[model samples]
Target: MVAETTLRPADLIAPLFVREGVTSPVPISSLPGVSQLDLASLRSEVAQLVSVGVRSVILFGIPLKKDPIGSGASDPDGIVQVAIRELRQCFGEEIVILADLCLDEYTDHGHCGVLTPTGEVHNDDTLVRYQEVALAQAAAGVDLVAPSGMMDGQVGA
Candidate 1:
């Protein structure tokens, strides 16, 4: 006899992009059906997911500002952090919330971490930013934090 297993909505993880300062949802060309959502739109989208029995999501943030050190990534009121709080309040353990922890989108350089004077990535410096981001996400009550740092030995750092 063979045992059969099937995929279900509850096991799927939806990736949502939250962009700061957006009043309306903006389509992402690379992702045909996915859009960078404003906070209001984000709530709506997650609601639909819950209705469909989707129990988990991962969020990526696009902040309104970009600086050399990615200050917004660790800011308490940053887009992703704000989303985490809102979702937690509304969902309250009904769904799993994960934050995509990275600085690529928050930094003007668009690199995962800080760069050195010679334009090479400064690993130690970038890890500091990641630590701050992880802390902020934890404080916001995220269920999980996945680093998008794209660096070798990121966890060890």
Candidate 2:
């Protein structure tokens, strides 16, 4: 049977990971054929994707340092921010860049929100951090922000 329609590379969003403090690409074993790339590799990777007609990419960052406040996530010079700036500069609005707003990637304890003294998640404090990250990403030319860490009211921000 013949197919009735076609889906092109431009029709989908490529999920890309950029890792700080790495000089080269590191393959994500759990996700075959996908890798966590450094800044230089990220530029090359996006170029390849663009050449293949990929028009959108959602970026996730793996910072060199993960602290209790997840400060790197909101840093103007953070990995994701730098990636966004580089992509926008090199690609010149040719791609739709989205930043993943998940705190776990930036948290030392691997939780999605700030931890209370009692080890409970503090929702409001987390929301403030999420906002900071979003603003920072926006300043870096991210087309969209995805709050995917399952924090309550995150999507509302």
Candidate 3:
């Protein structure tokens, strides 16, 4: 008899990237065999993942727009929000949906936090944006939010 491990398809989490503005999937050269998908393509990908016994997915959105404050990260109508809603509607809670809670993908400067006049990251100011992003992801029906920016007290904030 084969021993069964605790790990199962239910424990699998697929990571997905949603790129804003593009209507089709765009190749990500840095990550071979990966593409930044649009809404429609994302749906198709999710369907495929689920079909293959993957029960969950974590989303990272590449907004069509970015700003110093990472406004797109907190926008209710942003790419992640839209993707969350669509996934929920399609899977109807059968599939676990997660959102990446961070500022790097949404910040035009590519830093995880807001920068000061000295070009240094402002920690406290960035906490506010992280909080806002958490709330936004929750409101968008994300089952889980994972903050990857390594900011201090990000989970608490």
Candidate 4:
């Protein structure tokens, strides 16, 4: 088996949250030193991460708008897309940029899947949404996509 020592800076992937419309960083009480950063601040943060030993980052966007279908998730001008562009421009591919492929943050109900009329999670309908989100992230130039929704058939679908 490969030893832990084989791990290097390139193996580390830092997760960043880009929140909309907050000039200053807003600390997340549950996660210390992990704040919701705006675009400018996110750039600075990426710079800082690169200055250290990190060589990759995974981004999750907190959009300014939330809807039942989580439309903001796939928006080309969404926070995640903007963050990916900014980071690529700032780091010039020096860092591997990955995007979290999900809609929880963009959904007002806080559920990963689309809710049925009876308020139950709808899997098939959600898969369509996930596809859109995946395509959007790909269009945003994300090096990798991670779907964290734990939905069935997620890997194959």
| 1 versus 4: better lDDT goes to | 1
lDDT at 53 for candidate 3? 91
lDDT per residue, candidate 2, 63-91, as tens digits?
99999989999999999999999999999
Residue-pair clashes per prediction, in order, are 0, 0, 0, 0
True-structure lDDT of candidate 1:
0.93
Query: Candidate 1's residue-wise lDDT over 27-86, tens digit each?
Result: 999989889999999999999999999989999999999998899999999999999999
lDDT of each: 0.93, 0.93, 0.91, 0.88
Off by over 4 Å in 4: 1-7
Off by over 4 Å in 1: 1-3
lDDT of residue 120 for candidate 4 = 87
Evaluate candidate 2 by giving its C-alpha RMSD to the native, one decimal.
Answer: 2.1
Query: In candidate 3, what are the lDDT values of residues 63-128, reduced to their tens digit?
Result: 998888789999999999999999999888889998988888788899898889898889899999
Global CA lDDT of candidate 2, please? 0.93
Q: In model 2, where do residues sit more than 4 Å from their true spots?
A: 1-5
Order of quality (lDDT): 1, 2, 3, 4
Candidate 2 lDDT trough over 10 residues, lowest sum: 148-157
Candidate 1 weakest lDDT stretch, 10 residues: 148-157
Measured with C-alpha atoms, the lDDT of residue 62 in candidate 4 is 91
